[model samples]
Structures are given as C-alpha cells and as structure tokens.
Target chain A: MTEARATMPPGAGVVMPIGGAEDKLGRMTILREVIRLAGGSAARIVVISTASSLGDEITHAYLQLFAGLGVSDVVGIRPENRDQAGDAALVATIDRATAVFMTGGNQTKLATVIVGTPVGDAIRAAHLRGAVVAGTSAGASICSEHMVSFGSGGSTPKFRVGQVSQGLGLLSGVVVDQHFTQRNRFGRLLALVAANPGQLGVGIDEDTAAIVSASGRLEVKGRGVVTIIDGADVITTAYTATGTQPLMMSGLTLHTLPRGAIFDLTTRRLVSAPGLPDETEPPKVATLADVPEDMRPRTRRIAAEGAHTTTAELRRRPASS
Target chain B: MTEARATMPPGAGVVMPIGGAEDKLGRMTILREVIRLAGGSAARIVVISTASSLGDEITHAYLQLFAGLGVSDVVGIRPENRDQAGDAALVATIDRATAVFMTGGNQTKLATVIVGTPVGDAIRAAHLRGAVVAGTSAGASICSEHMVSFGSGGSTPKFRVGQVSQGLGLLSGVVVDQHFTQRNRFGRLLALVAANPGQLGVGIDEDTAAIVSASGRLEVKGRGVVTIIDGADVITTAYTATGTQPLMMSGLTLHTLPRGAIFDLTTRRLVSAPGLPDETEPPKVATLADVPEDMRPRTRRIAAEGAHTTTAELRRRPASS
Candidate 1:
C-alpha cells in the first residue's frame, strides 16, 4: 500500500499576518501571498469571515481584490449562529469554490458557526481537491490540527502550562499561533507544545506567513520569521502527584525559519526548497525515540492478578467505620 | 458502605472577586461572603496578592481587614521575576496559610508564574488539606478543575472546533468563567459545554461567587447570579469527518442561580439555602441518567463474520489488484 504521506496531493495554503490590522500593508501582503500561492490567480474564491469582520469595508476590499485578479465569482461564509445549520449558505457556496480564505475575528465564533456544518465539509473537500485555503490571525490559528487558546504569557516555561485549547484540524498534527513575536505569545506556545508532545507548534509573526503544502512541506514567508517548535525528541518528567519529581526532557527541536525555508512534516526534517535563505548549518531536528529510555514514561505490563489485587484493596477499605 | 457524600467534609474553596476591582463595594461584599462561608470573623485569613497589587496601599487595606476581624498573617507573593520562578515565593507563602487569596493582575502572568513549581504543588496540597483558595477576575478563572486558557467567544456547538487554553484544575470536571454577565461570556460558555458534554460549565458573574462545598453543595453569594450549564444529558451524533452526524442532546440542563441558592453536585440538584433571596420557583435540575437512550452514542457489539461470499470478495479484490 502507498504511504499516507506519499498519497497527500500537492496544494497551497496561505497564512495571513493580520493580527495587527492597523497596517494595511500587512493585509495587502497577505493577499498578494495568497495570490502567489494560487498560481497568480484563482477562478473561484471562497471567503470564510467572522461576523464582526464581514462589514462593508472588508467586503469591499475583497471584492476589489477579486475584480483586480479578473476573478468573477466569490463566495462569502459568515456564520452568525453557532449551530450546525447556521452557515448553510456559506457551505453551499464553498461546495463549488476553488480557493477558500478564512478571515480574522473570534476563532471560537468561527469554529462554532462553521464546524459541523456543510461549510466545514466543503472547506475540507476543496482543500483535498488542491484548492488554496488561507486564514489570518484567528483564522490562521484554527488551521492547525491543535490550537493554542490564549493563555497567560511569560518568558518561563511554567507560564506556558495549563493553557491549551483544541483547534480545527485542517492541518492535522500541527498547532498554529498568530501575532507571534509582536504579542509575545511564546510562553503560551511552549506550554501548548509541552502539554501535547506529539504535536508541532507553529508561531507566525505579524506580516508573515507559514504556508504548508499538501505534500507536507512548510515554507516561511512575510516580513518576520516563523518559529517552529518540534517536540518529537523530548524527555520530560516532573514532580507530579501521580508519581516522580524532576521531569527530564531531551531532544526537542526548535527552528526559527525566515522567509524561504521549507520543513518536511512527515519525516520530521527540513528540506531545501525555493525561497529559503542559505544557512551556515541545517536546522536542528529531534524525535522522541532519540531520548534516553530512563527519562521516558515507563511502559508497564501487569498481570490480571495484579490488577485484581489493586482493585480488591480499594474495595476492602471500610466505608466510614 | 458509608455514602461517600455523607462522609464528605464541608468544602474548602477559594473565591475571588478581585476582577471587580472597578467596584470596590462589590469586591468587599464578596470578601465578606467568603468570610461568612469560612465560618465567621475569627477564621485565620491569608491574602495572596500579585506584585502589581501588593504595594503598600493594598497591603494596608488587607491589614485593616485582617486586623478588624482579629485574623493574623497577610503575606504578599511578590515574585521577583515576572517571567520565571519569581512567583515561587508567593506560592510558598500560600502554602502555610489556611485560606489563600490570589489577588488580581494579568491572569496569564499569574498562571505562568505559578504553574509547575513548588508553589503549584503547595497550592494543590493546601486545597487537599481543606484550605480555601479564592481568586477574582483572572484569579477566579484559574479555580476550575479544567481552567479556561482563553477560548473564542461564541454561542455555537461545533465539534472539536474552538480554541481552549489549559487552566488550573482546582475544581475539576467544571469550566469556570469570570466576568460572566458583565462580559456576556454566556455564548462562549455554552459552546464549551456543548463541545465537552461531560464537563460542567459554571459562569461566575463579577462581584459574585458560587461557593461549592466539599460535599458538592454549591451556594451562590453576592449580587449577581451564577449560570450553570450542564450538558451531561445531551445527545450528540457523529459531526466530524471521523464520526456520524446529528448529535441529539435532550437531557442537558441550564440553571441561573441568584444569591443564596444552593446546588448539590453529588445529587446534581438545587436546594434553597440561607443568604439568597427567595425565588419565585425552584430551579430545575438535570442529571446524566435523565438522558434518553437513543440520544446516547450507539455501542458497537463485536460480531463474528462467517460468509463465504464476503471472503471471496476480499480475495477477489486482492487478486485483481
């Protein structure tokens, strides 16, 4: 059988750095990048925007952009209700689109409105069919399989703890955070990665984009760098009430890629690609298997008798007497 | 066996109304209520304030309150390092107190400073030993068993779709949101409840609190009401690509309790309590067992396959390939 990774088709994903909406240049750059990824022009474009951002100004800008590109058709999905059927019109529009764009706003609202609706299904289908899909700010956030809900932020890793939220799994096995450096969301992202080691953390700075292709290759674009937090090789053990103290983690990989670098998601490695700047040395890569065995979580095989004994002990305890 | 609920001691919980800093009188009322629940003025009191709120002026106020009540010891947990282990001292200060009060500041900072340290362990230990730990604003938020890391605000029920951050699980199996009514956080809370049916949702309005006892009795105090969202009885079907659709949730219950009403968590019922205003009608309650069977997820039973035609079909497909 063909490998799952190998079967993934080639497609384009555009990320917008519009968290700082004060700058029109940033928005324009994002649009330009989307167009570039869509091979200069897209035939059918679908806009998935938040209700708050669906006002006249944003809509007018989109209309002008599409018109400029000589694109005649555009679909806008604004989920006002969170119920599954709330975005029916949007879903129907997405069904026949060639490109999808998610706008910024409350990601929770976006997820609530679009998720479980026909629109979500259509978005996934379009992406699978090799259509370009893009998101900005909160939109960029939900693109990852795992998401970082806002958390307390600080420089210490401890600040990063206990603040994680689930995300739309458009890009499976990955976590995305927007307004990265400008907002100082590093501690929260680290906390997210720590909580879920198997997932990759992608932090896109303002005015920047981290576009990943269907073939599992990630390319960095925009004004700032994209911070990639890979925990494939981490050994973490801590003073947990459930057990031991002094948690140890080793072999975690972190990469700060500026515009023009490519990362391979499947093999968990970095590859050379167009647009990447030359580096003195290749980026560091690590996997969990590379960590020392003692530091890893112990895998115990217990007999049925032992399990019974544990349960019996609990059962044997007198109620209140 | 003795009933677990019967033997359970009175709940020792922390209530914070600091988020209502804008309303000093309201904050004082909440503090007074906390004092009442802790069994009157003679109870030992501890004030845990952040560096921002730990200045001389605030300390003087804490001192006056403690002195007036003949309570001793008000320590400030001033972490020298806002980004690192600076909050360790604060956590340690909370360790020795009977009741710990986490003052208001940047919740993200407070969480970052306290999570995964000796202080965090001490706080947990204090709770286990029946200490009251209360926080207002950001402080109130971290008091849940599954803390809200910061979720998107919306009133929709989409599967695996909203961003959620990790929170301190002081009160497990529940989601607690502060500034509830004032900020109109009901929509977000509802969406969270829908996404996680097994988890209870509790929204504490500013200047108010839902004082939950060790025996699982939750009593309301202060000016505003507590909105309790219970989704345990919902009937949901596969909504994601990996599952079925049309989630049927029938037995979910929602309760808005004003000051003085008590809710029993063990029985999942509400009972009238002192200090609350008289209600026109008793609050309705719902439990897991009340959910209809069909609304529940369908269980797949294992079956043995013994069809020659099926075997032939599988063999034929492989041969043809």
Candidate 2:
C-alpha cells in the first residue's frame, strides 16, 4: 500500500469520516490524510458531526476517537434552524478555520441549505485557495462539476432524457459517480457522458478517493480505483429517439487509476510520474470534432434569409465549380 | 392559499418529508398535499430521509411521528455505499410505495447515490404511474428536467452563464432551483434560461413545493412564491463577444407563483384554474425557432448538412455569381 501524506494550505475545512466509522482504522486514516492535505494537525480540528451523526450522544464518542489520535479543538455545529441562518453560521465557521470538514450525510440537505449562501461561497473560496477539502461517500460525490441529480434506470440512453438536478460544481468539466464498480453505474455514467460528451465522467469505487488539485490534476487514493469514462470520442447521434435507441458509442476511452495514480484534467491525459504506476491500458483520447454526427444536438435555428438558388444553376454558373 | 389537492391515480407514489423537519407543520401540510395528490392516505408512502438526519435519536422521533399519523410499513434505507446498491434499495422501496418523499441533505449526495440505480428507476416508474413524489429544498430542485448545479452568484443574467451542469432530468424541459427568493438565485436561473431557451427555469422558494403532473401542470404551495423565468421568447443575438457568454435574452417572462397559483409548463401560460390563483401577465408563447437572429447559434453546419452543398460551392459560387 502506498503511504499518503497530507498537504494542507491555509484555510479551514472539516474532513469527517462520518460513514465507515466502525472501521476506526479507515476513519482515522482518512482524517489524518485530510489533516495533512489541509496542512493542519488534529489539534486544530473542529469536528461538526452534531447535525446528524451525533444524536443525543454528547459527541464524546467521536471526540474520544479523535483524542485517541492526539486530536483536539473539535466543536460541533448544531444549528437551531436547518435554514439560511444555520447555513450562515456554517460558513462563518469555515471562514474562521484553516480547514473545515463535512461529514457524509444527505448531500441534498447540505446543498439546499448551503448553496448560494455565504457558507457555500466560503467553501468554494477555500477550495480555490487550496485549502485541502475532502468528503467521503455522499460528500465525495458532490465535489464534482456536473453531479447526478437522480435519474431513471436502464442501461440504454433516452431523449429529453436524464433527471439531472443541480450540484456543487467544485470540480468543473467533470461528472462524478461514487461507488462506481460496486454499483454497476457504468450505464448511468455512460448516459450522462452521452448527454454531455464534452464533460468527463469519473466513476469512483468504494473506499477510494480521487483527490483533485487546484490546477486540474487528480490523484487516486484508497483501496479501490477511479474509473475515468471519456466520451469525447464517442460516435453516437440523436440521444433522444422514441423507439430507436441511440447508437452504442465507439472509440471512447476508459482509464482505471488505482491507488497513487495521477490524472491531468486540462489535457485529459495521465501523468506518468515516477511514484505513480500505470495499471491498465489507457483509452483513446478524443477531441471536440470527434463527437458522432448524430449525437450532436442541433443547438441552432437557421432561416434562409437570402435568395434560394437551384443546385443545377449554381453548378453550371459557378466559375469555382 | 388555494388548497387544491394533488390528483394522483391509483398505484401512484407518496412523497415524504424528512430533511426540513424544522418546518414540521409545513412539512406535514406538504405531506398531506402529496397524499391528496396521490389520492389519499391509503396510498403507500415511502419515507426517504438522510441517514444523518435520521440520527439514532431522530430516527425514533421520525418513526413515532409517522406512526402517529397512521402511516406504517415505512422502509428506511440508509445508503452505506454511494452507488447502485443504495439506489437499488431506494428504487425497491419506491416500487412498493405509491408515494415517495425525499429527505434533504446534499442534492448531489442523493443524486450520486440514486442516479442510475434501481431506486432512480423506481422513482421514474412511480412518476409515470402517477405517483405523487415530493422533494423539499434539495429534493424539490431535482424535480425539474434542467436543474441548477451551482453557479457563480449574481442577480444579473450574465452571472448565470458557465455554471450549468447535468441534472437527473426527472421533469424534462424544465430547470428547477431551490431556496429561491431567500438566496437570490434569480440571476443564475435567468442565465440558465438564456443559455437553454428550449427549457423552462423554475425557482422554488424555501418551505414551498410545486406539485407538477405528467400533463405538465404545476401548482405552487408553501410560504414563499415560486419564480418562473421563461426565456423562450428571447430576441437578442449579440449577447457576448465571442459567443462565449450566453446571448443577451430579450422578452424573457418572469412569473411569480405565490401559494395556490398554477403554471402550465407546455403552453408557457398561467391558467386561471379554480382555487389556483393567477399571479403574472400572460407572455407571448414562442417556439425555439422564434429566437432572435443574432442571439441564435449559427446553424451553418445543419444548413450545410441539409443542403448537401460543399463549402467550396458556398464561397466560390457566390463570388463568381
């Protein structure tokens, strides 16, 4: 296993391993990794697990778990109202801290209450400032640019298709699906990719983290791997057909990055660093023009504003012809 | 408030509220409205709440709350894996439910765990089956076809550009935004409308819900008003310099639906239905082809494809003629 180090910038972000806490080792490892990434220590940690995880209990269990690792300075953010005011306080906390962690829960609740508020803005600012922010499970899923808002089943694609709701576009130009392989989400991700070929699809496995940097560099960490589904080279047309389904995509790329692998988002290429080991054959890179003829949506409406000429007359009269 | 009930057919869905429990009374009212829509309390109800919100203590509180309301057979599914299994469970739960309610957390989390899952399929199935599915805050936002993923905040139309992402596409042809007036998300929604003129943008205020039917009718409920931003009749071309920013939109229709008001998604008109109040002036209904010349995207590719003309002929023949 590759031993990961944390590099925290100056800002506050809470990294809580809300789920899988039964595995103390895994939780602690993730917490330590977040601390290192945020360039902070456990002492400076302010745990905010009170909203959900710490019900009735005094949050002592969590504090003890952190204290066992020499972590202190934790505080819980239990808001009276799960509305705008509460969101404001959460933002104030984030603004005051060097790193603030958001434990896994209901991403919709978090986004609904926080998005478009001071706190949401602060979180974005912290990320842009390179304050190592991390989330697991639900938290991890919301960190992407285009998030899955929930959709219908079926491996096939449909038109006027996809129930895409909003997401926190922290990681731009990419759509992320968590628990990828374990969940058989390939079809859904593919559908999303088909809908927006310009965006990259990232399917992350359980117990895995695809840590992205400020400059669009990605590093895969944890037990599982990160699958990159690039539909940039797909050749399907007409995503919305009633009976006839869209053509199956060909010439697309799928890259599986195991632990310690790095990917570049800008060029959509894998960086061959010394420490990183390549595990599988990389897929073919795609360009904008490589998009299939049919799948390309006709986004424009044209009117023949000028004179209509006959093909035969044009062919005979044109010197260029 | 125009207390018109939700009219769901037999075997339709039941929507539950869990995240915004602070609005317990409002939540129950919305629940009653959903039940009414699904055709009564006999309908099977699916309670979808975040694991975090259903904390050890709160879980019991919720269990008691529902039990008191004569609702039983509730299946609680906490998504341990943010992928297919979680979604599958949700779908399965919905499959047995006539009404499904989504508790809020992070909209992204709900989408990440549910999009492409059996649960997502179930939700769609229920919707098709005339089930009254309801989501609050984050849940409400995901109900539309095109949802706001999160954009740079501003009140101007220009600030809404470059922030759109793929949503679950539940309500096709509409964009849904939550925490509307409270957060001042109008600018972003407007930009979204201008960006995709073919779609209707809906901004749902907090503590409110919009019950939409398969026939494309929308009824507003709750405290604040629902803002409908319609840019289908835009008439400007040169909104941006290099076609980067969305073209400046003109003749945009802004409708504010207070409690009890109903809006039609298809006709782009607000009907004077009994009990449901009319809130805005009727705007001219325009199709996608009616957008202004300059504002419309260049259709040269489609024109060339349609005409079967070579680029050489288009340029040289014109000069020679």
Candidate 3:
C-alpha cells in the first residue's frame, strides 16, 4: 500500500524523531522503521554521531549493530571539527546514503558541526531527495527549524526553558524535543512553542519515533507517545509577567498520540490507519473543550486560527486516497 | 582516600540515577564513576538488561562497551521470563557483583521481572553491602520508593501523570526521573512529589548522573544540571480539585544544581564549594519567603518538619566537623 501511493510528493523523505533511550539491541523498532522507509536492507546507510563526544564508540557500535542486522553497506562518521564537517569526501558519503541515523549526545555539538558545512548540506539535500533521516535525543532536537539549544529545567516553564536556535530546518513550522516521556520535557517544548507562537511543538517519547513522510504524513510507532503542542492560537501573560513568577498561558492545544495513531500534518487531524486506529473509530478534531476551565480561553484562541481542525486532529481519510 | 573515610555508612552504596542516552562509547562519565565506586577495574560488574525487551541486544551492547572500557570482569544477563528472574545462578552473579547496571527498556517490564524475585532481593542486598547500583531511564525509574511507571506526557502535570507503583526502593524519600532536561519532565516529577508531599523529586538529565554516597553525601556531575524538587512542604489544591484541571501547587522548592554542586541530603542544603557563589555570596536557603507569594506557605510546612535546614539551604558547615 505504501508503494502504491503514487501521489506522494517528490523530495519527500520520512522524518523520524526518536525519543531518547531507544532499544538498539535486537529489536531496533525505530531503526528497522528507518530502514524500511529507506527501501530495506539494500539501502546505503550513514550513521552520524557528532552530538556525541564519544563518537568513535557510537559509530563503531552502530557499525556492528547495522552489520548484525544485515545491512551490507553502512558508514559511520563523527567529525571532530567544522573542517572535518566540510570535507568533500564526507559530503559524497552522505549524498549516496539512503538513510541517515544521528546518535544521541549534545544537540549543540551536532548542530555546530553539520549546520552549514558540506556534510550538513549533504544530509539536508539527501533528506529532501527522499532519504529517510532519523535522530535520537539531541539528534532529534536538531531536526526542527528552530532547535532548543539550552533551557531552564523544571516541570513548568519559567521565564525561559532555554533558547531556540537555528536547526537543520528539515522540518518546518515545528520545534522538536526528544526523549519526551522518559525525560518529561513537556514544559520546555511548550515554552519553546509559546515563545514562537506560530510553531507546533512535537515531543517524542523514549523507544518511540514520530515518522513524518515528505508528503506530510505522520505515524507514531513504538512503546511511548508523541505530544503535540499547538501554540498557533495561544494567549499568554508572558509578555507582562516578571521574573520568578509562574508562566501563564491559554489556548494551547495538546494532543498525546499513542503508538499506532496516525496524524496528518496537512489536514491537521489524526487519521484512520489501515493497521491501527482502524476505521471504526471516528476521527476526532483537536479542541479545547476537553481541557480544564482555566486553560480553555487560550485554547479557544487557536480554534479561531484553524477553524476546521486544530492540533492533535484525528481523522479517517477515505480509502480511495 | 575513599578507604580512609572510616565514617562511611554500612550497607550504604551510592545510587547513580543516570538520565537516559548516556555516552557509552569512550568517556562514559556516569559509567566510569560507577566503576570507580565499585573499585575500578577490579570490580565485578553485573549488567542487567531485564528491564529491556531487547535484552539480548542491550546486554551485548553493554558487554562490548564495558569490555572496550577494559573492565576486567563484566557479566550481562537478560531473564527470558519472570521465572528466570529467580534463578539461583542469576542470584549468584548478582551476589558477586560489586556494581550492577540496569539498561533501558519498559520500566513495567523490568519491575515485573525483578520486583519480587530473587533478582530484586539480590539487587537490594548488593546495595546494602555497599555495591554501587546504577540504572538509566527505566532503570532509574525503578530505583525510587514510588516508581513513576508511566504518566501523562507534557510540560505540566495534568490529571495524575500516569501511576506510581512499587520500585526497588534503593533510595528513600525521593522519586527519580531520568532524561530530565532533554525530555522536559519537570512537571511530572513535580506531580509525583506533590502527590507524595514528603518525597523529594530528583530529575537527572541525559548524559548526567546524581551520585549519592553511603553516608548520604550528594553531588552533581556531568554536562547537565540536576533538578531537585522538594515537595515535603507543598501547598496545593490537588485535594480540593478533581479531574483534569491544571494541578495547582505552591511552596514547592526547586533547585537546579549544575555539575560540581554539592548537596547534603541530611542537611537539606547546597553546601559550600570553595569557588562558586563564593563567601561573599550568602547561602540561599529554600524558604517560602524566597519563593513567590503563592508557594511560600507549603514550603514553610517543610521548615516545620526539618528545623535544622529546609529547601535550597546553602550553608557552610562548621570548619571543625
């Protein structure tokens, strides 16, 4: 069925945002999905671990794991500096890759190395040319247009959870946070979205992945859930609040997409899946009515922005499409 | 110097709750610390992958990683089922281990396997005998008295963030949340603390570890900061409110301790570290007065409980102690 979809967009690659602490051993749930999206075992794979200080170890570990999984051609690279990131040979290696896996480490490190270098250009270019691009933890954080560089830590967002910096920009209109549930990063992601009210916040849980097709199709797979924070219609008192006070906001729509749930970014709704969230369950549009009274006014603001559908929309597309 | 600390507590081992996605390749900041605490290269390390569904793969990954690190004796074991968790041989391996490491997987799977069986008994016994016990992600979740098995995913705590069940109970008066900063789990951890009221919530970040000595001495290390939420004195309307309303609580003392920060659990204070916030910088004790007006009252409740020191206490002990 996936192959039969001839209407799929060009330069459309599957964007997989993995929650951190993935099961890499025998059942590489997320990895296998990446391989599947990249056209199976015959695909050329490149594993990048620039986010990791221990790059050699991550690269070698993937080398053996991918080999064990029967992928014939796999290359692992960890550039020590920008000069290495700009190497032409490295660019060539990435260019020919069908899938790219960025390991967990420091998001800043990964962004610094590949953002504008030859290697970085190759990845963005490859991703645009229908190659599957996957990242876990920091790697996942760098996948969005505005990556969260650093932030304040806590359950609720303070004045700042950290800063949002330029990311690889493979995915637009959204910011990504990895290891979502395992780390409980909802607040920081929300803060990021609140600061940049136009963007959606996608938080992927551990051992899970949010797979986004180039054509804007999304499916969540694995053990955890994907939290979607739509701040497009939020109204917050952040602009008036001073330091040390709790942040107050309204109209933020949040959706928790469990494993097997399918989402449509374009339609802005959770849709029916052939294998999961089957046809019987009617599609549910994202709304604020379900939220507590205090948070409704702000959520209602977003409703005005997207009249038919809001964040966390679930729908069952007609089978014909 | 470690041996010279004759005042060390018996059956007291340091509990390292490493946030998930640790750097296992070359410089395993957290793992190396576990090794050092367990007597370095000479220690008998037992790696438990039972928490992981992909036990074989995780076990193998750790075996190679540990071996690469040149640890002389390392054993990896993944119980195929619950019954195997009681195997005498498995118990024997744990008994001889100077350090035990639990890999990441489903916290529920791990709890089901090791909670009641000899495996759990062996782990508790190992820690009691001063064996360094460490866990990441799911492993870390199981280290607390109230394990956060699963919860609502987001930045703020909504209706109960999932549930808390029985854990290994290696650390008391505290609940552990891993991948803290990376995942933005501050709210969930706070919810756990708010529910328990008396338990301190320790949220460790990715690539970082919170080290607790047998003598109850505490220190923060690695690249990220440790978010310590003391709920011993929270004032909230959780009891008055019902269902899905945003959780309202105050006087919940929050401390973000970066690397090298020393905390005295017994004193409930961030103690003196010669160079930082130097002598001119007065110690900051966590008080209701310190918090905004909303949180002051409940935090004051904790002060009534532990008169000597309370939330965010930073006092230099008398020089002659």
Q: Local distance difference test, per candidate?
A: 0.57, 0.54, 0.73
- The TM-scores of all predictions, comma-separated, are 0.41, 0.39, 0.46
Query: Which whole-number lDDT from 0 to 100 does residue B288 have in model 1?
Result: 52
DockQ, computed on Cα atoms, for candidate 1 = 0.03
Question: Over the stretch A65-130, how does candidate 2's per-residue lDDT look in tens digits?
Answer: 556766566555543234643476576666655555555555555555555556667767766654
Q: After superposition, how far is residue B32 of candidate 1 from its true place, in Å?
A: 37
Model 3, which residues run further than 4 Å from truth? A1-321, B1-9, B277-321
Model 1 — interface RMS deviation?
22.2
User: If both were scored by lDDT, which would come out higher, candidate 1 or candidate 3?
Assistant: 3
Q: What range of 10 consecutive residues in model 1 chain A has the weakest lDDT sum?
A: A238-247
lDDT of 3 at A111: 90
Worst lDDT window (10 residues) for model 2 chain B?
Answer: B311-320
Give the poorly placed runs of model 1, Cα more than 4 Å off. Answer: A1-23, A39-42, A51-57, A65-72, A84-88, A159-162, A238-251, A273-321, B1-321
For model 3 the TM-score comes to 0.46
Query: What DockQ do the predictions score, one after another?
Result: 0.03, 0.02, 0.05
